[model samples]
Target: MTSVHDGEATALGMAMEQSAGTVMIRAYVAPEQMGDWTIRVTAIEAQVEHATPGLQSYQLATDVYAEQQQARTWTVTLAIPRVLVAGKAVQLFNVVVGELPRLGFLTRFRLDALALPEDFGPGPGFGAAGIRQRLHRPHGPLLCRAMRPAVGVGTDTMVRLNRDVLNAGYHLVKDDEVQVFADNRAFRQHVEAMVAARDEAQAHSGERKGYLANLICEADELAERWDIVKTLGVDGVPMSPVLQGFSTLSMWRASGKCRSLPTTPSATC
Candidate 1:
């Protein structure tokens, strides 16, 4: 018999067993297809065992249904037995949305939400507290500066802008997500110049500041850029995990090179 975790948060708490795996995903469905959706969603997610013995499989355990748009729209919240995905967020997404297209029961559907177990990855290496400490701004709103016209802006221009911002009392400055490994603006030179500007500004402003350099590059080149940032002693770096892949960010955090400096995840422009 399949274990059904019903109710709301209370049942979710009760379903948390060491051996029991579970995850919650919300999908929209047509009002008429709720019955078939309940049956197929559960079986496809959890019932089909993985070909590999140790690999985890999900079963649709329970669902919460709701009506919206004057009963014109229907949404279902599916409680699935948790399946662990170690390295690849892409694989995790595959598990969530891969089977839906094969089953043509729902009219229009979207994977809207995901709830993972508490014991996930290393979490954030430097969280808000750490970022505050690094920037030397313990309280009040944090000020941020961004490098505009990211493309074709050479290292000299970037360093000059950072210098102005640092002197103008901006606590944190970041490279635009569009700024990747470019010929005109190389990663190493940009970081080196930013570091130089930061030191020069600190001497005058007497306030500590940080730089979140952009590391949006090819998947294979992520590690190389991360190393450049660390080696050049850049204060921090901004990573576009959606574009560069979340696994890259995970590797950077686990690399232990960014332990002292903070790493921020940015969305692709």
Candidate 2:
């Protein structure tokens, strides 16, 4: 993790500095318009310092190559200042989307992926280690299942269903993002029910089981609910990066508030 205090956040310096501040984005451009696209990207690169003062522009490769998706793929790596992010994941989103939209090919371009430096955030806090730990199966395979018929089931009913699965030797059970967290199926009710179910399962099976509650909510409400889920003894949390924004996961990692907890990203992302 390169400290943002090392020097002024110059794009070139950061990009060249062990790839600390580099953020890679894959974009699609037309084969014939490669030259024009290159110029546009270069111009955007040049505008970085102006767009974000104190953050110097960095060098990037502009070679255009064809991909299996029938469009030419152009990988652009931007070196942004670490200070600007200040450990806030949303800043990464701003760094990427803020400048790229200025290009004329915005409509034709498709952002395929983002490759971030490890210092950026502790990605997928639980990951393989956390998942295995949650299952208490250090040397064996872990199991996971989601609550079916996604919606319309009451909180109590969902709890009983989850309890049954856990007692049946399932390692973990998660709620569908759409099933709860809405007006009718309140988050508090669902979390309380889940905690109760987990307790019952543990007492009955004599083995640990995990519950991944949906933490999908409006941005303003997420922090509050996340804390509640943790304090209430839920095993893990499931969130939709697309809906809640990727920064949400970043915040969870960078904030150090949920370091011990595991998070399950919505499969749709």
Clashes of 2: 0
Tens digits of per-residue lDDT, candidate 1, 47-162, equal 23212222122422334322211111223444543343443456566545554433312223345577767655545666778878877888998888888877786777878888
Query: What is the TM-score (0 to 1) of candidate 1?
Result: 0.65
Local distance difference test, candidate 1? 0.57
* Model 2 ranges off by over 4 Å: 1-88, 105-107, 124-126, 182-185, 260-269
Q: Return the lDDT, model 2, position 104.
A: 23
lDDT of each: 0.57, 0.57
Model 1: which ten-residue window has the lowest total lDDT? 65-74
Candidate that would win on lDDT: 2
Worst 10 residues of 2 by lDDT: 39-48
Candidate that would win on TM-score: 1
